[model samples]
Target: MTTEPFLAPVTTPAERREWILRLLTGTQRVDRIRRLRESIILSLLFLSALISVATTIGIIYTLSIETFHFFQRVSLIDFLTDTQWTPLFTEKHFGIWPLLTATLLVSAIAMLVALPLGLLAAIGLSEYASPRLASIVKPILEILAGVPTVVYGYFALLFVTPLLKRFIPQLEVFNALSAGLVMGIMILPLVASLSEDAMRAVPQSLREGAYALGATKLEVVWRVVVPSSLSGIVAASILAISRAIGETMIVAIAMGQVPRLTLNPLVAMETMTAYIVQVSLGDTPHGSLEYQTIFAVGTALFLITMVLNLLSYRFLQRFREVYE
Candidate 1:
């Protein structure tokens, strides 16, 4: 066998330290890094902040410009006062009410479906379930939230509508009921997760105190835990309401494109976002007043959602307690 070249033995700690120092002092890489001595950390943070600020400014500026154009053609009164909507036709009428009605109708339906189911789920997760069971179920419930809205829309349009047509034949292909119901399912995880957290935050001492006073489990939960967590529940509900209002894709697909003043759930109706989508998807000229209508509708939606979210945040802040 051929012998390899003999290497020198390792040095003592002090000798090794000296060697490392000499090497590092002469290193070109370190010298280069030292040369560009500007605060790279600060530059990165400032750049990130600049991007965020720029994005906000761009959105606001674009929306404001188009909304101004739209308002010049359609008066504020015409936009707000008129109840009838015929945007795409020869008889062009601008009305906020029909869109508002469609949005509210779907939102009301979503709330109705989400509230009770979410509350029950929250109660189960926080109060009734074992730790092992909760671990299994919570992630499963979250999967429902993870499903894409467009998929939910398809399920609503294809499955739910056909099923409903079996009983209520008058139920239109793209009615508010299917859209609202699917929206509720889409929003279920939001309500359930938040409400569960709020319910879980209630102290065990409160439940024990109620039980010590000869209260049943049902009574303890209803009187003590639920009441103490009332603010949180309300906050969660408001948050869910905010989501219901802003939901776009599901509404656009499952709800019809028709902009109608009718209150009937069976009739086809268009939401504000849906109206924007309908207009933008059409072949209207880019600079025309008609194209600008999208931004005006968007501004209206933004105002509504912003108000709702602000209210929710206020509720959460006011109602939150120091559990300690």
Candidate 2:
């Protein structure tokens, strides 16, 4: 004879109902726990976004308040039309043109140098270079970006200026040319990396189609790849320009603090960033007009950067090519 195990069956309706409720409760509990975790993750992401927004708002507010005070003391017409920028001097003339022109000139030179070289590098990396070569070269190229601006500043002052002086005897020791050239070198990696990524994002099918039409490698790259990636390239250039515009240390060290409204790159000049740095060195007393000038300059810089970003966004939206 074998021993049999007894099992309890839910014979009563109440017992069956109780069993069903227990199973439902377990599933509901699991669902509730999942929802809670999801809510926590969502909250964290929202907080991160909020923090960024808050920081931007805070900066804008600070700039705005101080800028308002500055404008109250100095008329807008004088600020815009005045050729001299001698805020720190006893004979104060509050024209922003000198700083503005110097900023533009340096940025223009940087763009001239960086754009062509970077575009060429990007093209070579994306269309011509082997994967092994690209992998090795790209990292080495990006290493330039990691080098400090202060180091670049000293290099421009100590090395590049002296070297250029040999070729061009007219070049000033502390001039816009050396600073601009070094600044361009500093920003080249940004353009190359970004433009290469954009070029690489272009669909391979487009290149194949161009090749099928008996196009050469150069033709395919210039016509198919470059056109498709134009938005990204332009965006990268704009970003690099903004970087050059806002550059402080390199320009400050290499380009002398003489605020002059001249297009001559061989002459020493002061940029808006350089001006801000000059003021921020703690020599200017707090609550003074000299101190307030930094805020006004900052507001202008903020506006310029914001405009560039907006233009980049608009261009990307208008010209971005979508691939299936």
Candidate 3:
């Protein structure tokens, strides 16, 4: 290729100055085009975001306003303080505790089962498993996620409940424990997959250096991999918790429509989603406060899940440290 400068033919000082000015102007024009494109793209994204936020806030606002009207008729103090939650009766008691307790109990059981098992699986996949083992096992783990939740609900109701009854006679046929345990299994892929990604991203040189210093595989994993991936592990746990909280069909079918204010997982309980399903399945009157109750429960559930996500993000920010 010819190596002569493009400006070589412009030998005169005047020509050089003109050429330089032309190049500078051309560069400025290109910069302007790039800036305009960036601004347009970003503005479109920002506009989309504003619409999303407005829609979300509008729903919350509409629900809150209607809920306030409901409270005026139903009494906020009683709703907050009372234990019973029968909203469709002549007596019309509407406490938030039963729903809250049910959601809490199911989520707690799910977390109890999912956390340790998923984390261990992630550890094995990232730290100990051979390539052949991973190739065989990863798909197997993911299969759990692919199973339809309705099918799990069916199994929980027919198979699991009966099986549990054989061992524990007092266990309810439809209980929080069965629902939570199944929900945990359902969300296992979320925790294991994300945590494995995080662990794999840890610097290989860190492991190599540890091994060079006479560290065993266990020591390297415990000290380096787990610590480095702590933020991601925590985030996975939080996400698993979120999934457990939001699961619908499994809890709806397996967990009975009994919104008890008890912590005992052996007893039947109804989650927020389950109660919503129960209420809607009955085809309750559209304009009734009972119909609007789902939206209120939904708003509360939304806030709780959002808080958990925010907390997870904060943990991610604090623990992530990458070095050159």
TM-score of 1: 0.85
Model 2 per-residue lDDT tens digits across residues 1-324: 564433257658998898889889999999999999999999999999899899999999999999999999999999999999998788999999999999999999988889999999999998899989999999999999999999999999999999999999999978999999999999999999989988888988899999999999989988999999998899888888888888889999999999989999999999999999988886888778988999999999989988887887775565555642
Candidate with best TM-score:
2
Candidate 3 to truth, TM: 0.81
**Model 1 regions more than 4 Å off:** 1-40, 46-54, 319-321
For residues 1-324, write the lDDT of model 1, one tens digit per residue.
665533233267887787778788878677777766556767887899899889878888898999998888899998999987776778888888899999999999999999989988888888889978988999999999899888988999999999999999999999999999989988888888988888888888889998899999789878888888888888889999989998888889989898888778886899988888788788999878778878888888888887888888887775675453
Instruction: Report the C-alpha displacement of residue 239, candidate 1, in angstroms.
Output: 1.4
Q: Is candidate 1 or candidate 3 better by TM-score?
A: 1
Residues 92-172 of candidate 3 have per-residue lDDT tens digits of 778889988899888888888888889999999988999789878988999999999999999888888888889889998
Q: Return the TM-score for each candidate structure.
A: 0.85, 0.90, 0.81
Best candidate, lDDT? 2
What lDDT is obtained when candidate 3 is compared to the true structure? 0.85
Q: Against the unseen true structure, what C-alpha lDDT does each candidate score?
A: 0.86, 0.91, 0.85
What pairs collide in candidate 2? none
Candidate 2 — which residues are off by over 4 angstroms?
1-13, 26-41, 318-321
* lDDT ranking of the models: 2, 1, 3
